[model samples]
Target: MSYREERRADAAAQAEQNRKAAEARAAQEREDRRLELETKLKAKEIAAEQKRRDAEAKAELARKEAEAKRRQELADKKVRAQEKERQAAARRARFGRVAGWLKANPATLFVAFVMVASIVPAVISQVGALSSAKVHVMLAALLAAMLEGGAWAITFMGKQAEDAGRETRKYRIATWLTAAAAAAVNFWHGLEAYAEHPWVAVVLGGSSLFAIYIWDMKTHGSHGKTREERRQEKARKKHLADRRKHHKEIAEEADRLLSALPFESITEEQAFETAWQIKRGTQPGLSAEIFAQVTGARVQLGAAFELGEHVRPELVRAGMLARLYNPLPGRLAEGIPTLGPSVPVPALQQAPEGATALAGIGVYGSEGASEKACEKASESASGNAGGNGSRGRSDEELEALLPKALKIAAELVAEGNQISGAALSKRLGIRRDDARRLRDRVIAERKLKLVEGQADAAVGA
Candidate 1:
């Protein structure tokens, strides 16, 4: 073979091999693209299935929610219906009770009917349901009904007042006037409605009068009260009188007990403590008046001591001597002269230094001179005799005067008057010491709480 021929054949063979290889490569690429499209289609089907399942779940949830909402609404409706039924039942019961009461009270029922009917004519007129002439007749009927009802009420009231022992003249007069007016109105209306038959007017007027008479007879009969009822009333009055008498006796006893204490021997503090103890120990509680009496006795004793020392020194000295010597004799001889329980005298040994003036019958030399000088100075300072020679008041007398003094003090305090020793002394006609004790007693008893400056202002005023 020629070399050129060989080259050309070899080239043809190479081209054929290249063509076959190119076709094989194109077939493999077409198979790969088909497999990729199948995979994409499968994934798309899977996603569509998942989306449909999600939609079904959402729709089911919504349906369940709607069902729950419907059930709740039904439950609320049932609750409301039950509440309404309960309210209706309560209203029915109340109405039944009212009907029973109205049925029992015929007079009250009649009055209620009249009052309701009185407004009906005006209502009919406003609604344009009645002619002018008919409206006037209705109004006249209403007036007659009102007057008759009023007369009945007044007659009943007068009878009740008379039964209760109250004056009934005014009620009787009102009933008479009302009955007359009712009869006149009824007769006038009857005549206007039935002019041809005069007997009708007379019958209407007579019927109203008869009704009033019947009501009066029913309310106020000849045998109004039985003998048994009268006896019971008398017994009740007697019981009340007995109760009043018992209370008065108890009060008197309490007053006596409160005033029985020897206030002159005890200090104010001791007296108050003893009084509180007695009050607590009392069976039937003590009255405020008893407490007032106790306070008054303490104040009076203190006042007598202070005033007697200055004004009636002789009496004070004699009282001191009696208190001292009387105790000495009892101490010296046991059971000597049997005297009733006497006020205990404080021992001279307990007296503080420089207080020998306070000892009974021991004021000598300078002490006596000082006491005389003090008496003269006080007498000159107070031109008034300081109530000299006046005997000390007994607890009973002091207690009797206490109420007026307390009332005055209360009035002064209520009027914004500051309470002080001086104010009390001047207003209550008491000595300064008595006023001071009274003020202290009131404060201790929680009757008043005066500020510091207020008491000073009261003294200056």
Candidate 2:
């Protein structure tokens, strides 16, 4: 405000302006430094995130590659298995074809041989016997006609077999049947010739015998049953048998199936599906893969059934009941010891706690075993059962079960005599260890016999 004060004031004002400018510059510099630090932190975070993303992408690519490789290997394995199965089926088909070819041609060759060797000799003898030698011409004509007929029949049969796509049995039966009829005709012709010419009749009789013997051996001896009888029996059995069995049988047939299932282990659901397939008569035969999966599980599960030292009461009772209900529908004829058709088998047989009997024989044959042995075994099992009967069984139920158990035990004795323990165990799904013990007990108790090993050389060699 004064001269000296004014100069001082001007200096003071300049100083104040300088102070403000310096403070402003300092604040701007601090702000720029803070921004630079923030930028550095953001850049570091972005680099870390980018690295993490790259690592995740790499892991994802590796997983995809591994999955693709696994799929390729599985596909290749399936293809190889199918190819092998196809080759085996082809071999069987070829062998069947060759066998069919041989069967059809043999009869023609046999007829040719007979005509050339025997017929010519007979004709020559007849010619010599002829008063005018014209009989030789007639004999030759007859031989030619017979040979032609044989040729026609052989050709017709071969063609029919090829066209019909049936097995060899039909052709064999037809050939033998026709030969038998022809032999009868030949015999009648011999009888006629005998009235006029005795020598000719002798030749014809010899031919007839040869023909009949060959035909009889071929038709009756080989087959054990006549073709027509077999056909009729099959039809009758089919008519009587429950059609449910047909579904199971058809599904088990080995044709019209391609691939096996794809599973390391099949669940009960899969088994149920398989049963449905069988029941529906849809797929024929399980593939080796499916079978392998099932058998592998079966081995793991081990033997689930028990074996008995004596006869099983349940089977015996069932068999007796079947006998009593003589001519009972479908299953009774099969002679299988099961609960009645109306009875819910699954419910009745659940966890099946009954005696393990000899499983090989039918009911009646089992009933005939030494009654003494049966009585002894039954008394023992019944005694044991009675001791345990405190668990609660009505008198009626016990009475019913005892008779049934006796019948089953008797059946087992008869069955054990016929089949070996191992076969019986396998058939009935019983444990081998249990079967062995039961077999030993039966033998020790005289319910079964143990035949000592015979000298193989003396018996068969």
Alpha-carbon TM-score of each model against the true structure: 0.34, 0.27
Candidate with best lDDT: 1
Where does candidate 2 stray beyond 4 Å?
82-150, 154-461
lDDT of 1 by residue, 1-461 (tens): 99999999999998998898899888889988999999999999999999999999999999999999999999999999999999999999999889888888777667556544543432222222222245566664565456666777888788889889999889978977776665665566567767899887776555556655555555566446799999999998886566447655544444455578664555533544354446554323344564455444434433334334334455446456646554234543232222211223442223222222112112221223334443444444442222523343445644565666566556654554333444556776665444444544443332223344456788999
Candidate 2 structure quality by residue, lDDT tens digits, 1-461: 57999999999999999999999999989989999999998999898899899999999889889999999899989898888888988998898887787688676557566645653443333333342334566774565445434533653675576557756566555554654444444445555546677666566535533543444344346647788999999997775353336544443331223124444355533554465565543332334454455444323211111123233476345434534554335654233223222222242233222122233321112322323333344344322322333243444543444443434444545444332234334443334333333433443333332222234434775
Candidate that scores best on TM-score: 1
